[model samples]
Target: MIPIALAPASPPERSAWRRHRFLLLRRSSQLAVLALFLLGPWAGLWWVKGNLASSLSFGVLPLTDPFVLAQSLAAQHWAEATALIGAALVLAFYGLLVGRAYCGWVCPVNAVTDAAGWLRRRFKLNAGSAPPRGLRYALLAAVLLAAAITGLPVWESVNPVTLTQRALIFGGSVAWAAVVAVFLFDLAVAPRGWCGHVCPMGAAYSLIGSKPLLRVSAAHRSRCNDCGDCYAVCPEPQILVAPLKGKAGSGPLIQARECSACGRCVDVCSTEVFQFTHRFDHRRD
Candidate 1:
């Protein structure tokens, strides 16, 4: 267990809880969202009527993945008014609250990749000659172009995120195989690589929620010990470098779209260097 920022006067149990607090909360959120989808089919409770890609809660609150919507639009597929509203709601939620948050909190594939990251850490492994970070953008462009060319939502037809969920619900062998391949790729080839480096959907989220209001700020940058633990734990380590220690423009609020706003940095920093703050609260000095 990493020793996060803890009050010296706090008791041991409290300290332990504090260290793992955000991580536990995140896991709970992830599982709860998954349960919501499962509840409809498993227990005959139609509270939500779809998977993460698209869902309507209580038969009213519609939510749709805007990236999927974008692909559909590119492929010249026209969605109804309700689906448009759902996409707008999703965009507003992610834009107002957190960017790329889906990657960290709601994506089921996140658990798979997180497990891979844990295994990599346990084995003391290092990524070797990984593809350029910009490959994701290229892939994003390629997917869009493919959609335009083929007049079909190509990625949606076979997206692992959706496939994994469908597999869990319907037991599709091909979907499970696709998911397992992703897990193995993350575990053996790259550490924190899929969402961090590739994933066109993540790129889309980052753009949609580019200047999200909820952000993880380096509020206590003065106390930083250069321990490198934050970098070690952060899925998007490059996003932290400028805010933590670099040129002045980026400020304490991590402005990069790639930031998932995952609290690992805050949870691991024993010196209390990192703290969550709004996008406007750039107290850099």
Candidate 2:
């Protein structure tokens, strides 16, 4: 067995790292808000003005642009098909290496919610709890089915990034305004509300997250005091907390399909209760 060691550091060093992590989270939240409120809308407007396909041009990630791939796949054009497949493989590889860090650190909607929740705390509004984990899968199925049948990328309509971009560029249409309002309310009132309960991309990640490779682990359970700080701070609390509390089964490392592996739990845990591990090790736990 590979031996594990504590992250070599004094308490002061560890504390400094914690502060840095929190700062990163806060800065990420700020950038997300800016992107959603400013750049996203501009991109959307450009797409609309040019009559360009949103996915093909204005999507959050270039790899996620479904229109080109969908068209290629639908047409069964070998050259386009090969290119699309290659791109997909690259994205999958990148995701495995990062472990959904994008969802926690970079997703615009998630940032909006984080900012909203920060504001709501002053009003004593509690962060809303996540809905049933199964809901995401159902939503994913519905979205894919609709996209397949209608040949319209339905994800664009509800996507927070796209909505934000549209709102920024169009100067607030009714639809864009609603999207912004919902995002603000959900972020402020609910932790990862958009991602935890609604994001179809999250559903896709959850399905494949449990591969035997590229997992996180809790290296020193004995250090745990059960203070629950990690649980309290976890953005994807349902996934991280319930399992550690022994209230849920361990299959998917985190139960919520929405977990973005942002390392918030690791940052908050006073006991150093968690770390990245392989799936084989995660199952053994």
Candidate 3:
């Protein structure tokens, strides 16, 4: 007599778009930012100009990187009123909303590192040797110090972020090798290593958005099954520890500045435990 085989039960997704809802939105936003920059040289529709460091929108709205401004000041470099205003605008925007979300949502280099991370996980690779998170701050300090010592904004010359964006718009250059090195480092050296613990830009933005209005809260921890899926997906997994495990006194919010607000935890959880909320929402039930 042949025995009947029972199929394995597959867990169902909670939303219409399934687990990929936020991921899709994030990818589209990243690509769209790149497109706006490229549209000028590529299609002759110059909606945005000058890249993320400093950009003018339709030749009016100016956006600049506050960190770059800081480095310039450290280097004893003079800044015009427009640059000051532009940096303030960019700082205010990041402060009020996304924080280091730029690292996850807008950075052009994110595409390569993310692909490396995905491939790393697919191969079930080990964490390998990675530097401590404090290295990011060290790198940040070093960049400023280099600027001061050299009397120049040194990092801007070879920053992989700008290199990647420029390479995207223009044809590839020697910077392609740098971009490829980052991909290989993230893939083989360590997973999520670059953005999570290495990029000074991400570290600076994390500080800028240290008290951002927008945040991810483990609001419904009661529904969590201790499945560890969120931990696996989070770029800064350490941030989730306190919020998810904290009792009534610990607050339900993940307040770590390093939390990129990338929403991968929100995307991957089968139980729908995480949600975006204001910083004050401490619904620890």
Candidate 4:
């Protein structure tokens, strides 16, 4: 009879592969943030110059962002009003699907904040308690009011995206330096402090995130031993910690509007206590 040989176990090799894949997702997000900060606005400008002004003005521009292109378009095309309407729908769709995950994951400003949080941790600085959850909403209201009253995009003055673009393209300015400094300082003090407290886009997302849809939820709750590993790994730990503690009971809950849906919490959960789920699905123990 021919000798039968079993293949040696490769569990360790498979585990290493999985680890590498996870790291790649994390690192790629960081790199993408840096690229967006440097390239996003210029890309918008290019679209305008290439006769795709509608795409830039309506389809991609954030509502809080300056409508420079929109105003220019108005001057150029008096009857072409559909583009703005189309853009609004797109923005609404984004808000519905994943809330401000775009801001946390894709916005260059958030990337800067992430870097700042790293530097803060390196120095062992304390950022203190997180700001009130309602602050972003207040800021959004103020921005909209200012824009309406002044007939100009007031967000341009404070938008990190615009500031970063101008800093890079125009060889730096005091505003750019100041914003960068705050981002770095916040990083030294608080992890994701900026997104959690101050982003208007985040405020917009939070308003609609509770709608029925697929979202991150706590799974395998009985497996949890309250070790807090998930909290430590979470960018927005406060958002998930209370619920995880069983204080909020077993149900879907979002800890904050700034939750980026990055899956870091899921990755870090030692007992696999978190999973993504739709609104109608029953919570599994």
Please provide TM-scores, in order, for all candidate models, with all chains considered together: 0.91, 0.65, 0.93, 0.70
Give per-residue CA lDDT, model 2, range 107-224, as digits (tens).
5555566666556545656756756666877876777667667766566566656666555556567657766776665755455566666666666565645342555455455466
lDDT of 3 by residue, 1-285 (tens): 899898854456577676888889889999999899989999989889888898899888988898899899999988988899999988888887777788878888887887987887788888666689999999999999999999998988888898888777775766787799889888888778889889999999999988888889999887788889888778788889888888566777888999888888988888778999999888755
Question: What is the lDDT for 109 in model 4?
Answer: 65
Model 4 C-alpha lDDT per residue in residues 53-157, reported as the tens digit of each score: 123432455322213333333335332345556546545655567655555455556556756765655776665666776787898777766665666655656
**Candidate 2 Cα deviation (angstroms), residue 157:** 2.5
* Winner by lDDT: 3
lDDT of 4 at 105: 54
| Higher-TM-score candidate of 1 and 2 | 1
- Residue 109 lDDT, candidate 1, scale 0-100: 85
Worst lDDT window (10 residues) for model 3? Answer: 8-17
155-219 per-residue lDDT for model 1 (tens digits): 98778899889888888789999799879888888777788788899888888888898899887
> Which of the predicted structures, 3 or 4, would earn the higher lDDT when compared with the native?
3
- Which is superior by TM-score, 2 or 4? 4
Off by over 4 Å in 1: 1-14
Model 1 clash number: 0
Q: lDDT of all the models against the reference?
A: 0.84, 0.55, 0.86, 0.57
